[model samples]
Target: MSLNVLITGGAGYVGSHVVKTLEKSGYFTVVYDNLSTGRADWIPDAELVVGDIGDQAALSRVFKRYSFDAVIHLAARVSAPESIKKPLRYYADNLCGSIALLKQSRKHQIPCFIHASSAAVYGNPGVAPVGENAPLLPINPYGASKMMAERAIMDISGSSDMRWTILRYFNVAGADVKTCVGQRPENPVHLIPKACRAAGLGQDISIFGDDYDTIDGSCVRDYIHVKDLAHIHLLALEYLAGKNPSIVLNCGLGRGSSVKEVLNTAQRVSGKNFTVNRKPRRPGDAPVLVADNALLKKTLNWTPRYQNVSEIIETSWICHQRLTGRRSKN
Candidate 1:
């Protein structure tokens, strides 16, 4: 019998890619999205259900209708600045919704659970390459919500029959190389996609805080290709299916790229000389955050294929141009 996977927030940027990957890998996939930030058109071939994770009635119905062997929970309100402005909203969506989903999953006896966590969980650590064992000092409500959800899963794992893997992502970028899906947030705040859009329109892009302590005096982050991240999810699912131990993995290449560096690469890839305006740093902004993905490689035997910076930028630029109908300068 084939495995059935239920992906919350499956119509969103990263989740959509995971759905497409699962479909290609011959798994029966079902996507549950509220269309709040996700596009309905993204999940065409898979079983798509429009619903909220917080809605117990909706979740219960979906669980009852399908025999999901595993659950990949991605539904959440993921905006650091916005989460600061509306903390209650973040808690409700990120924390409460996850609890509700886990409750429903337990009720249905689903064995595997995979969560999409963020690097914001390690807020402004003095350390360079953060590891899984690093201190989790989240500075914002968005991070707080994800941390809370991770704790909930850990606690549930001790007693419940559910096994889980939590992947803490750092600066997920790039698009599906196959062009099957791409990032389409309602109001995208991610650097690469937003920069691509600005370059496409010949608009001035803002570089938030160029005075941070780094090689270029700008905030540095590790950007991981979305396709690579999706592949990690598939590996985690297979690992869990084999009754492997519950684990937490930091997903990223163990390298740092500054904001100015990203902007330069975007301009080069898009062939557009877009202007950049330096601005004050937003609240809860970290000076630098890079991952130490040694554990992920050692444990899972996983190697990231898209390791080149230019390749990531080019793939993202192509997808942005395709969506916006504005080709980048050659």
Candidate 2:
């Protein structure tokens, strides 16, 4: 029997990708989202329930309606700068909302829980390729909210039978293979999509702080393709279903790509010229963050397909043109 997986925030960027990936793997998928940032057109065929994760009454109603075997929690306010400006709102939504979801999970007795965590949890690790044991020093409110929710999960799991896996994602990029879905945010901040759009459409791409301590004086990050990251979730679900112990893993390429490198790759992939504007560093921006993916590899025996930054950019540009009708002739 296929497991019925309840994916929160299934209409959003990464969640939507997971939805498509899950369907491809033959899982019975159900989406629960409030449509705050998620689009209605994202989850086309999946059963989508328009509700907030923080609403216990609404959650109970949904839980009563479906017999979910597991859950993939991806719903949260995910903006770092916005979180800094709206700390209380972020806490209420990300932190409090997760607690509410856990209450419902305990009520439903869901066996497995997969959390979509972010690499921002390690605010500023002293070294690159930080391991899972790295200190959780979140400099921004968004990361703090995630760290706090993780603590809550740990405390709750000590008493409950919920087996959970926390995946701390690095910079997620790219789209589905057929371009069925991709990042469709109105205020896009992710580098790959932004740069790809600019490169193909001749728009201005802002380079944040070209004075960072990196190869090109810009910040370095581990860019993981969305499809590869989606497969990691599937692997985590299988691991949990096999009655394995709950684990925390990082989803990344185990390498680094500077901002300039990414922009150059985007240009090279699309064969277009776009203006690059240097801007001041945003608050709480980490100089470098790459994942030590050895544990993920050894634990799940996972192999990433799109590990190259150029491949990520290429796929993203194709999807961007398909979605926006900005096909470039180069």
C-alpha RMSD for every candidate = 2.3, 2.2
Tell me the lDDT of candidate 2. 0.88
Worst 10-residue lDDT window, candidate 2: 321-330
Give one digit per residue, the lDDT tens place, for model 2 in 1-330. Answer: 369999999888788888888888889899999998887687797899999888999999988999999999999988788888999998998899999999999888998999988898999997999999999999999999999988888888878899999999999988875854646623467888888768766889888799987788999999999889988988899899999999999999999999989999889988998989999998988999999999999999999998699888888877777766632332
lDDT to native, each model: 0.88, 0.88
Off by more than 4 A, model 2:
185-187, 326-330
- Displacement of the residue 25 alpha carbon in candidate 1, Å: 1.1
